[model samples]
Every structure is written in structure tokens, then in C-alpha cells.
Target: MNPAEQAPSYRGASEHYLSPSRRDPVKVLSEEPVTRRVLTEALAALALPDDRPVDVLDIGSGTADGFSLLTRAADGDPAVVEEARLHYVGLDVDPEMVETAGEQVRSPSASFVHGDVRSGIPGGAFDLYLSCGVPYSHLTRDELVGALRSVLTAVAGRGRRAAVVVDVLGRYSVEWQPNWHLDRWDYAMSFFAGGGSGISEPMTFYDAPALTSVLDEAMAGTGATVVSRTAVDRSVLVGRHTATGTFNPGVPRFRTLVNDLLRDPASVDPADLRFTPATGGAPRDVLDWLAGFAARWNAALQPYTGAGPLDRDAAARLAHALLGLERAGGPGLGVGHSFTTTLVVDPA
Candidate 1:
């Protein structure tokens, strides 16, 4: 799919953020603890000069929220925020987003660019390169590699060690398990409430292995070498784009529980369900219900464990179970809604 066609939705969303009441849900969930954590991880990987302003480039930077998060996270540390100045440059395909970001992210050292990062990254070498909000999910596998290669070459040219953070949609996320078998799926709706141009765009999903392979291939001939990688986030709840028609409207109790869980993951009480819909369990107990459903789900997916693709039905079932449970221990690579990988790139 052409990236330009999908610009309307993002353009509309950028305008929505300008409104006091409206906020992008994906950014809200990711910009805080999630982005901050990854930012810290990525920054810690780089060997940056403390006496100079840290040059940072945010690819697919929508509203420059990640930049803001970085500044806020380092507010207490005078070294990162003050002594080493943060010169942030953000790039986005949507001109409106670029414009809005330029206005909202007003800083002496911040700049916004309207361009496609896959073709070429703007500016000189940056100390940090961030691609959050699952921007890479929109690219084809080949395009992703080419884009990464371009970025790596640019960074390599400067002969500077940099930190690059890549964020993508997880294949094992509960939000889109129904379509996990496909390498790509059409996602509809805006990520914000009362946002989105009511359009669907093709998006790719990835597990840690698949993503790591892409990065390795992209950097094979470049000066950038990934030193470390860590996946984080476990968004067990429904995402804004998937919530519109994710569940059957005929089942109100199940739908209500799912909605509640999405609204606040920690505030939900699974015991409040008035009825047991699909997964057989007592209506008053959530863990029992999750365990039973998980057994069935894992059983269905057992054949695909460390093997081939999961059965669509089985994937959907596992996703449902995970959503109902709202938490789990295991791999964050393929399971998180916004699974992030922070790589400390060593300059060639």
C-alpha cells in the first residue's frame, strides 16, 4: 500500500490532538512509561559526548511526543537535559503532523521535517534515532531493510555511535490475533477517540526473531552494529483501532468486560462479569476462567510453538484468553501491542 494514501488518517489525527479534549490513545499509552523506558534503554547504549548537545532524530515522530517524554524523563538529571543539550529533529510523512509538532514541541533545539524516512533521513548524524508508534509496521519487509540501511549508512558516515529504537506491532498481541496468520492486515479507524478518517491501511506484524533478522540484514553491510536489544510492553487490552468491531455485539457482557479492561488495565475486576460467554468458567471467577481458556488456547497453539504459523482460530482464541486475563509472564517480543526494541548501535 502506498504510504501517501494513509496520510489522511494521520493528518486528521494530528488536528485532533490540537483539541484540548482529544488525544491520541496510542501515543498516550506509548509516550509515557513505555517510550520513556525505551528511550532510557537506547540512550544508555550510546557512547555520547557529555559536553555537547545530544543530536536526536525521531523518524515517524508524530507530534514529537517521544521527544517531550525524553526531556521530561531527564528533567531530574541535569546532565542529560541541561549539560548535554537535546537537539531533537522529528520527521513525519504528514505535513500537518509536522506542522503541529513544530508548534507544540517548541524548543530552542527542536525541528520538524515533512518527509518519508524510508527514502532518506533528513539532517546529519544523530546521537539517537527513534521510530516509535509502530511506524515500521507500515513498511514492507524489503522497504524496512532499505530504510534501515539508509539510516545506518547515514549514521556510519558520521562515525558516531548512536542508539536506535524501533517499535512495531507484535504478532502475538491480543488486539489482532484474529489476523495473525497473514504477514499483513488492514487496520481501520483512528488511534484516538473521535479521530481517524475511517480508513483502513495495510500494516505488518513481527515477532522478535523476525524483527531482529530484518535489523541484522539491514545492517549487514553498514557501519551500525546492534549491540543489545530488549522488548517491552504487554498491552493485554484492546487497542483503539481494533476495538470498534473486535468483539461480537451480541455478547454484551463479554464486550463490556473487554471495554473495561481496555479503559484501565489495573482497575478492572474480572469477577464482575455477570455471565460466562465462551470460555467455560464460573461467572464469578476470572483466573479460573483464564486458566481454562488458556489451556484450550495453548493446546490449540501447541502445534505452532517455535514452529510455523498459528492457526487463525487458535490465535484468536489465545488472544481472547490473554485479553480476559489482562497479564502474563513470558515473551514480550511477539506478545505486546507495541513491542519495542532498543538497539545500541556501535559505529563502524
Candidate 2:
């Protein structure tokens, strides 16, 4: 999508975030925790000096959600984070989001500005540059490169070590199996009421190779060298769309069944959670991963199937096993709802 066409509109985004689906068990128990692990690792790598407050720039900072996530991650070590206070600056193109964040995240150390990453990343030399919620997916391939270049340039200019977390839609998510062969598509936020303004917008999806190429191009001659990089997949099977079934209706509602199990094990029928892989245009490796995951996922729920309503203890065990499966699935290969690549850059 062109930069102009990709302008964010949060008309119903707040409402969507407040919806019950947003807090679904899969998200609370699975997605958020996995993402937090990544963020925590990135923060630890920074090893910020205790001299001054850490400056943070959040790209596409929707309602300062990234701020909240970072704060929680830092909260793990209150002495380090509280002593070196976080000075957060969130940038977004949507005015409503900026205003909402300003109102909601009232803090002397935090502020929101109306801007687009494609134009430029403002107020940098930051200790951390964060993007969550697949914000980079809104940009076309070229636009993504430009945005990253801007970030790299800023870090290099300041000649300070920094961390950048790039989150984008995974091209091979089971939620959109039909589009595995394509890098970009019209993605719909179908979890919202009435199918979320009934509009689908063009979004760029990324596999490891494609995203690596973009980052390489962005780093070219930017005077920034990547010290380390880590990539992980979020929501391998229980992505929100898995329950909505808007794109891949043939897939099982793993998200819904998981939520049911989390809320009330007695209300769930284990048979409904069985995963059956379908033939698609995805690469053999991706298909193989899905098949392996499906086998394990099914096995986890097998003992409970037809065992009648599960007791609370049994249900908790199943949930823990499922979450462990997702975490141990290994590095992301675009086989999840969102793929996050964290880069620790040395501005030499």
C-alpha cells in the first residue's frame, strides 16, 4: 500500500480492543506472555547506563499500548527501571490514537506525537525503538525499508547502542493459508463487531527471508551494525483470526476452543479442538511445521476428548501444556499470526 493510502484510521480500534475477544484466554495466557518474553530479552540486552533516564521511541504507538507492554517488562526489575526512569515518546499518524494515548497514559515522562514512520522517525537517539501490533505490516515493502532506514540512520547519527523491535504480519500464518504464496494482501480486522467497519486494507506480510532482506537493505551504509538479532513467532495456532475463520474457514477454531477451556473446562468438548492440516500453497517446511504442531496439539487434548467435562485441574494442565507447546515451537518462520524480529544495533 502507498504511504498516503496506508494512513491509520482508528475509528473502531478502541472499541475492538475493549471487546471480550481482545482479552481472550489465548491472548492473556499465550500471546502476551510470549511477546513479553521477547521484549524482556531485548531490554536485558540493552543494559542501559544508570546515568540518566532511558529514552524510548514507539513507532505506530496505538494508544501507547507499546508503552504499557514495555513498562510491564521493565517492572520485572523495579530497581533498574524505576531508578533509570523511562522517557517514552510514541509516534502515530492517527490523531485519535495520539489524543487517546495522551489522555490515558498521563505521565510526566511520556508523550504522544502525530507523525508517520514513512515520513521520518522523530526524537530518537533512543535506548529502545519499539513497534508492536504488526504496525510495520501496514507499509509496503519499499515503505518498510524506508522506515527502517530512518530508524537505523537515527541510531547511527547518535552513535549509541540501541534496540529495535520490528513486528509485522507473518506471511505463513495458518489464519491466512490461502495467501501463503503472496507477500501482501487485503487483511481484515474481522474480530471487531459487524466485521470491523466491513473494510479490508492492503497489508504487507513477511517471512524471515523477506524481512531479513529489508533489514539488510536498510542497514546498508547507515553506519549501524547489528550486534545481535532474534526472531520469534507469536500465536502459531491460536491467532485471533483462527477463531473468526474469516480467511481460512476450513481450519479449526483453536482460539475459541482454547478460550472455552480456559474459562470453563466443563463447557468444552475436546473433539472441537482437534487440528487437521489442510493442503495449501504454503512451502513444504511451513506445512511440515503445521503438521508437527497439529499432531502435538491433538495429542495434548486427546486424553480429555470424550472423557466428559474436564475438572478444573485437568483443564489447567491442558492449558499449560498448550502454552508450552507454542513457546517451544522454536524460532519463527512466518508460521504464526505475527513475527517479531528484535535487533540489538551498535551505532559505531
Candidate 3:
């Protein structure tokens, strides 16, 4: 099958959903500080040369919010902030998106282009090839492999070490349990009605092994090699979105319920913990509900982590475990709402 055939074309309806003015929930959720941390960490992994300004190609760079986020991350570091000069090229398939992004993202080093990667990635010799907002998840495995090879080949031609970050949907997410087997699903964000324009787009999901397989195939002949792969954005809170009637009939009013629990765990009485088949209510206990979700995700992750089902106390254990660490995104707590497997590739 043609790779482009498998990808979702976000026109008209979808275009409105990506508008920065609308405060798109998915856009807001994906661009959360925690989520943006993944990109910042990937930037740090580049170990870029100080001798020259870094050239970056951001694929599917919607609204170019990520460019702004990256700049903020660099600015936070006094040591490298002034030392690092960046030239960013934001590429998106949507002409409107490119135009909109061009307006929002302004920098002496940043430029915007309207193009599709299936055809070709514009510019060349970029020190960093970045893809966020699960852009690769729109392509089929074959399409993804082909696209990777194209960019890697271009970077290889330059004969310089570079890093590529591909962010996609996670397979075992509670948001789409009913459609997990199929690689593609219509992701609904009805809550962002203003942004969505009453339309959803088909998106593909991936596991680590599948991602690794494609990356390996893409780099086979090229000088690029995978240095490391890190999983980030293990969101324990996103499954609550399931209650919004956008996903399967599982958790009704999950966000409201989770908010109650977050505010006062004791306020949720024991009676509330019972699942109601008649109403399709989530588990009465918030932790138990989250644990069940975690267990299901763990089962899907078994092939990659070789770990058994996570327990009801998993979140608490993870929280306690995290206190000892000085950082986040070390390894997902196995409860991410959407996981990003950032493969650090070196095109030396």
C-alpha cells in the first residue's frame, strides 16, 4: 500500500483544531511542560558542537509551539543559553498551519515551510531532525521506514553527527483500548469542539520494538546509528479523558471524578469505588482505577519490559520511588497517557 494512503490528511476540519487561538486540548496536553521535557532532553542528548550554530529541521511542526518551547528550555540554562545559536526550519503539510506557525514562531534563526515528508524533507545538513506531536504515527510502518531513510540519507550525505527524535502514539493507551489491535484509530477530541470543528483524524500507534525495527531498517546502509532510546511522557492522568465520551464507554465523567479524588481522596467514599455496569462507571477508588489501567498497560508492555502486571499500589510506589531521583523521564512509571520513544540517532 502507498504509505501516504495510510497517513491522515488534516484539512479543513483538522486545520481548525490545530489553531493556537482555540487552545486545543490535545495540543495543550501534548505540549504540556512535562511533555515538552522530552524534546528538551533530546536536545541535550545531541552534544552539539559549539563551533557552529545548530541547524534543526522540525517535521510536522504544528504552530511551531515546540520551537518556542525549545528556546525556553535553552534559556533556562545560563551556561549554554548564550553559547548555543540555533537555526530552526519548521515544516508542516498544511499551508494554513505553515502560515500560522510562521506568524507565531519568530526568531532570527527560524523559518517555516509548507511540505510533506512523504514527498521530501526540505533543507539539508541539519544537526537535529525533530518530529513531535506524534507525526510519525500518521504513517504506516512502511511509510515510516521510507521516510526515515530519506531524512537519514540526507543527513548522512552531510557526513555529520546528528540526532533525530520521532514521537508517536503509544499502543496500550487507555484512550483507545477498544481499537488497540488496529494500527490506526480516529482520535477524538470532542472537548476541543472549537478547535476540532467536529472532526477527528486517524492516527497510528506504536510500541518500542516496532519503532526500533523501523529505525534499524532506515539506518542500515546509512552511516547513522542508534545511540539510545528513551521512553518519556508516561501520563497517569490522561486516561481520565476516557470519561469524556470521546473514547469507549468505560469511564463516564472521568475528569470530574479524578479531580474530586485529587482534591480530597477521603471525599470519595468506599461505596464510590464499586464499578457500575449499568452506568459504565470507572472503578470506585481512584488509585484502584489507575492501577487497573496501569496493569492493562503493563500487559501490553510485557514484550518490551518483561515485567508483570503492575499492582493497584503502582502509582504510590512510583511516586515514592521518584522522590529519590533528582530528575524525571528516566523511564516511564508505566502509566503514561501517551508514551514517546525518543531514539537518539547519530549520523556520523
Identify the candidate with maximal lDDT. Answer: 2
Q: Which stretches of candidate 3 lie over 4 Å from their true place?
A: 1-31, 73-84, 193-196, 252-335
Q: Of models 1 and 2, which has the larger TM-score? A: 2
TM-score of each: 0.72, 0.92, 0.70
Error of 1 at 296 (Å): 18
Candidate 3 residue lDDT tens string, 112-218: 99777888888678877887667787777887888889888887777676767777776655555565566677776565433455546776666556667877898
Relative to the true structure, candidate 2 reaches a TM of: 0.92
Steric clash pairs (candidate 3) = 17-195, 234-336, 235-336, 235-337, 272-284, 273-284, 273-285
lDDT, model 2, position 145:
93
Q: Name model 1 segments beyond 4 Å from true.
A: 1-9, 18-31, 47-49, 73-84, 194-196, 241-269, 272-330
RMSD of each: 10.1, 2.6, 8.8
Best by TM-score: 2
lDDT tens digits, residue span 282-323, model 2:
777777888888899899989888888888888888888887
Q: Write the per-residue lDDT of candidate 1 for residues 1-348, one digit (tens) a residue.
A: 655544545646764555543433333332344556667667766755567778888889888776766776442542334413788889888888888898887778788988887658886878888887788888888888888888888777788888877778876544554555566777664444445454468887787677878888989888667677676644533344344434223322333344444454443344332232233211223234334445643454344355434344544443345443433322445555666777777777
Give the count of colliding residue pairs in each prediction: 0, 0, 7
